[model samples]
Target: MFKSILVPFDGSQGAEAALAKAAELARLCGAELTLLTVYRHHSLLEASMHMVRPDEPADLDDIMRTHAKEVAERGRALAAESGIPAPRAFVKGGPVARTITSFAKEHGNDLTVIGSRGLGSLEGVLLGSVSHKVTSLSETPVLVV
Candidate 1:
């Protein structure tokens, strides 16, 4: 019953598996798929500021954006190869969970498909789990494939 599906990709093996699943679901349902990749807006060095070199350029924002775009492009290619025509691809900068939720809301997505490892809980706290937060906060359905 899903008309639109959102799949977030991080270029990891888990994410690739999720993307394949999303593509299959979209193809089966004849639904539109949006492939999204999010890159957080800072680097470890930038966050720490421990070794700041005067001459070394620190365009962390641009770097993150570029990386996100590259990931999105790869996802797009995969979808295209799978015969999913013109799957929408977007790169966003922010916390993964919030960005994914906002993108789904903005796009009116009916379902989200993501990998479980991407939502791992570690050290008594979910460290980098976008799927967990999105499932908790999103009003739409989330399928952790």
Candidate 2:
């Protein structure tokens, strides 16, 4: 019964499963599917650690955004193959859980399908998993795979 469906994908196995599930739901409900890849903003100190030289300039935000775009594209392709037509994808920079939930709310998506575990391990254990946070924050229904 969903009009629009949102899936938070991170190129992880769990995320892939969630995407597949979302695709099936979209296909059955005739709903549009949107794949979202969330990346955290990197600080100067964090960007510097990846640099090999003092003179080297790191465009960490751009790099991360590019990577997130790729991840979203992959999810979109998978959804297409699963019979979800015209699936759209987006890359956003922010806190992962908040970004996902806010995007779903802002877009008026009726349902959100997300992975129970993503790339985060320490943060998941310490602060709770992103899926858990999303379920707590989102007003829409969330299905964690």
Candidate 3:
């Protein structure tokens, strides 16, 4: 019974699955489907480390933002192919989970369908995945696919 559904996409297999599921839900409920892709703003120090030249410099944040837009558009296209009437897509630069939850809240999304790799690695077990963080941070209902 969602009026609007949000799916965070990052060109990952898990995210693809979530997008498909969200599209199905939106179609069934006659709801709006939204796609969001978030990229982290790279620190200057981190960006500098990969520099191969002293004269020429690269803007990692801009590069990431541009890539994020492409990913978001791809997600939108996928949703359209899934038979959604129109899927709105957005790209932001920030911490992924917080950005996703904040976008959902800001857009009045009734439901959020996110993806999880479901990895059982010690790092994930100790730190948790983005999906887990989204569930904890979001006030709206979240479905992890």
Q: Estimate each model's TM-score.
A: 0.88, 0.93, 0.89
* Model 2 regions lying over 4 Å from their true place: 50-52, 55-57
Which pairs of residues collide in candidate 2? none
> What do the candidate models score in CA lDDT, each in turn?
0.85, 0.91, 0.88
lDDT of 1: 0.85
Q: By the lDDT metric, which is better: model 1 or model 3?
A: 3
Kindly give the stretch of ten consecutive residues in candidate 1 with the minimal lDDT sum.
Answer: 119-128
lDDT of 3 by residue, 89-113 (tens): 9999887789989999999999999
Report the lDDT of model 3 for residue 53: 59
Across 14-70, the per-residue lDDT of candidate 1 in tens digits comes to 788899999999999999999999887775768566356655556768877997899
lDDT of 2 by residue, 2-50 (tens): 9999999999999999998998888889899999999999867777687
Better of 1 and 2 by lDDT: 2
lDDT-sorted candidate list, best first: 2, 3, 1
Best by lDDT: 2
